[model samples]
Target: MRKLPNLFKFDEISDGDNDFKQVMVSILKKEFPIEKQSFFDAFESEKYKECAEVVHKLKHKIHLLGLEEGYILSANFENQLVNNSFELYEDFVIILETIENFLKNI
Candidate 1:
C-alpha cells in the first residue's frame, strides 16, 4: 500500500478557516463511505458504467485529499471501466482503504 499524503491541499484550500475545513471534512466523512458502497455495488453487479460514474466522484475526493498518484490511478481506472476493464481494481481498493483508515483516525 502506498503511503497517503497529508491533507495539505485541503488545508490550503480552507485557507486557515477552521469552519471551512471542518465543513469540508464533514462532507468527505459523509460522502466517501456512501460513494464507496456505490462503487462496490456497481462493480459487483458488473455495471461498469455505474462504476465509472462513482469513480469519477471518487477521483475528486482523491484529489482533494492531496493524492495526486491516487487521482491518476482512479482516472485510469475510471477510463478502463468504460471498457469493462478492472485491471487496477485492487490498487484502487488500497487507496480507498487508506482513505478510510485516515478518515477514521482524523
Candidate 2:
C-alpha cells in the first residue's frame, strides 16, 4: 500500500480531505503506463526534447506527491538533458522506471 504522509503531505497541506492530492493520484494512476511508454520510446529514439518535456511535467506532480528526492533528481536530469547531456539518459532509465512503479501503486 502507498504510505500516507510519504506519498503526500496532504494531511498538512490540504483541508484534511485530500482534494488536490486525490486528483493528482487519480491522474497519475491512469497515465502512468502511457507516460512510461512515452519516456522509453523517446529515450530509445534519442528524442531528448520530447523526453525532457514530458519528464519536466512529471516532476511537478512528483514533487506534490511527496517524492521530493525523485522530483529533484528527475527535474535536474531533465534540465541537463535539455541543455545537452545525453549521458544522463541511462541514469534516467533507472529513475523513470522507479517513478513509474511508485506512481502505479497509487
Candidate 3:
C-alpha cells in the first residue's frame, strides 16, 4: 500500500504561536468529519453538483494540509463531478482516506 505524505504544514500553522496551532487543530478536528460526511452523502444521493460544491469547500482543507497533489486531484474530481464523469471518484476516495488517516494520527 502507498503511504500518504506528511501533508500537514505544521510549521506554517505553528509560525511561533502555539495557541494558534492548537486552535487550528481544534477547528480541523471538528470540521473535517462533517465535511467528509457531507461529501459522502452528496455522492450517495447522486447529487453531483452538491458533490462538486463540497469538493470546492474541501479544496481549502487539502491545501491547508499541504497535499498539493491531492489538491489537484480534488480539483479534477470536482470537474469530473460537474461533467458527470465519475471516473475519478475512486481517486477522490483514496484521497479522503489518506486525509482521514492522517487526521487520526494528529
Scored by lDDT, the top model is 1
TM-score preference between candidates 1 and 3, better one: 1
Which ranges of candidate 1 are over 4 A from the true structure? none
Residue 17 shift from truth in candidate 2, angstroms:
2.0
TM-score of 2: 0.70
Q: What is the C-alpha RMSD of each candidate to the true structure, in Å?
A: 1.1, 3.9, 1.8
Top candidate by TM-score: 1
**Global lDDT of model 2:** 0.69
lDDT of 1 by residue, 59-87 (tens): 99999898999999999999999998889
Off by over 4 Å in 3: 1-10
Q: Residue by residue across 1-106, what tens digits does model 2's lDDT show?
A: 4222145454456556678768756776777667778877887798889988888876775676676676777878888878768666665566656666666565
Poorest 10 consecutive residues by lDDT, candidate 3:
1-10
Candidate 3 lDDT score relative to the true structure: 0.84
